[model samples]
Target: MDQNSEVRLEDAGDGAYEIVGTRSGDRLGRVALTGERVTVEVVPAARRRGVATAALREVSRLTLRDRERLELLIPWDNPIALRVALAAGYTREGIRRGTPELLVYSRLASDSGEPAPRLLPDLPGGELSDGVITLRPLGEGDVDFYTELHSVPDVVATSVPAEPKPADEIRRRCSRAATQWLTGSRADLVIVDTATGLPAGEIDLYYQEPPLAQAMIGYSTLPAYRKRGLTTRAAQLLALWVFAETDIVRLVAGALPTNIGSQRVLEKAGFTREAYQRQRLPGPDGGRLDDVQYVLLAGDLLAQASGAGTSHA
Candidate 1:
């Protein structure tokens, strides 16, 4: 159908629709409304050509006529559908907890003039330690220390994709960590050796938006701290912190199978190997490496705490 063709909507019964291309007399897509929620699906060829957008506008118009609100539930992974909804004047309201990320969008019929509240809640703060090691949030004063930690060869090899950067890039990353925390996207902590109170490494827990009770964790240790089990202790403490403070039910970690040291650290922290993906990660030198995935459930932590007769659970 030509772009200027007159698109028409026909009743397909029971709040269903058929968007037809007038010029070529072809069915472009479908739109359905059930209990104030509108969902649109366009043919592969008709996508991005304003088909979904046109249908969504019609839906909104109908909702307004009925003195009701317009809503759409779009998956986080489906950016195309989200774009169409936003283009049609729908504001993201919140997330409906389901698999991964199910974003809910709404626009009140009485007031569509302003944007909805879009920022996530700020993360809670605290310190976690196990006498030998501690895990704490990174601060402005930690930029230099974080930079030096990334400069360590062993640390760079395992975490970052490229060679170690100077202080400026590290500063940017540390600053981004602040933003991520404020937006509830991640929780980044500095691993400390309590004996000397020096930074031994760092650990990260990613994925903070709702409908996602699982987070992925990553860690790096400095050369000087290798073989000392400080990272292991820090990870264990982090697990405790995450479970106690947040609603996260599962924590995951990935390590290069060849990196026995990291595997050992996860194991010591009560994580169990779950999957082995062949050539799943890109190597630093443009090669592929196998990824060994590990996971720790909330129940696992509780069981461990009970076994040790500790009050962490």
Candidate 2:
């Protein structure tokens, strides 16, 4: 059977086209074409080979034969599909809302088209490991490590007012965090132990007000990783990065009045204790709790780095 003849491309109206590929009486895959866009769906058992690509190449040749733009939509959680789309020349064009789980990718039909938006930044230079711990960007792949860390008895006993979340819930949170990072709204990093290379904690800075260049910083350390000053070290490095690379002017943090560990971490990073809001937070067991607010001005960071100031925390 001729390979081209084995696959049938049919025009499905409204920018949808269909490709049916068969092998030994089994339907191997199907490709949908619409306008200049093609959606390739292949059997799970027949994946990892060039089957989808072969189909896509044929579809691209047919569609772009007249148009100059092509696009595809894939679930944001499907890394394999994402790789295939990127390899096939699709650049992510942000994500579509109300879809819950899909991402859109597109490319210009011309050879001189712009590259895809960057999803991550280059790792910054820093004293990553001071003989015990290392720090790096928190990636989507760290979901498992993060979930396990936060689920530990001691960790749950300290933070996370609610019970240990189900794995699916943790996965959803990770997905949302990745989306936030991709859209340039948040910057997060992980603290790792040199001996195990596992994420022992995390530090994140999220924009509070884009126009005002204000952000909020948060950090948490796993029970096993506590007492080594890891959170303090990681917070300092992240704070430095934000001040140097972004226009952020003020950083804010909040801690339960009893969370001395977190308070210490903030103070060590040059933040000043701002106010204590009475019953401003919820307790781990569900009651209201008092919280202390902290503020770190960009000038304070520069002053501390230049050895010209002292923290008032």
Winner by lDDT: 1
Each model's backbone clash number = 0, 5
lDDT of 1 by residue, 24-111 (tens): 7799988888888888988898877887887777667666777668788876446567667766777767879966557787777775
| Per-residue alpha-carbon lDDT of candidate 2 for residues 220-242, written as tens digits (9 for 90 to 100) | 77777787777777767667766
Clashing pairs in 2: 15-34, 15-35, 16-33, 16-34, 17-33
How big is the positional error of residue 278 in model 1, measured in Å on the Cα after superposition?
1.3
Query: What's model 2's lDDT at 255?
Result: 86
> How many times do residue backbones clash in model 1?
0
Candidates in order, TM-scores: namely: 0.59, 0.62
lDDT of 1 at 104: 83
Candidate 2 lDDT: 0.69
* Model 1 vs truth, CA RMSD: 14.7
Query: All candidates' lDDT scores?
Result: 0.74, 0.69
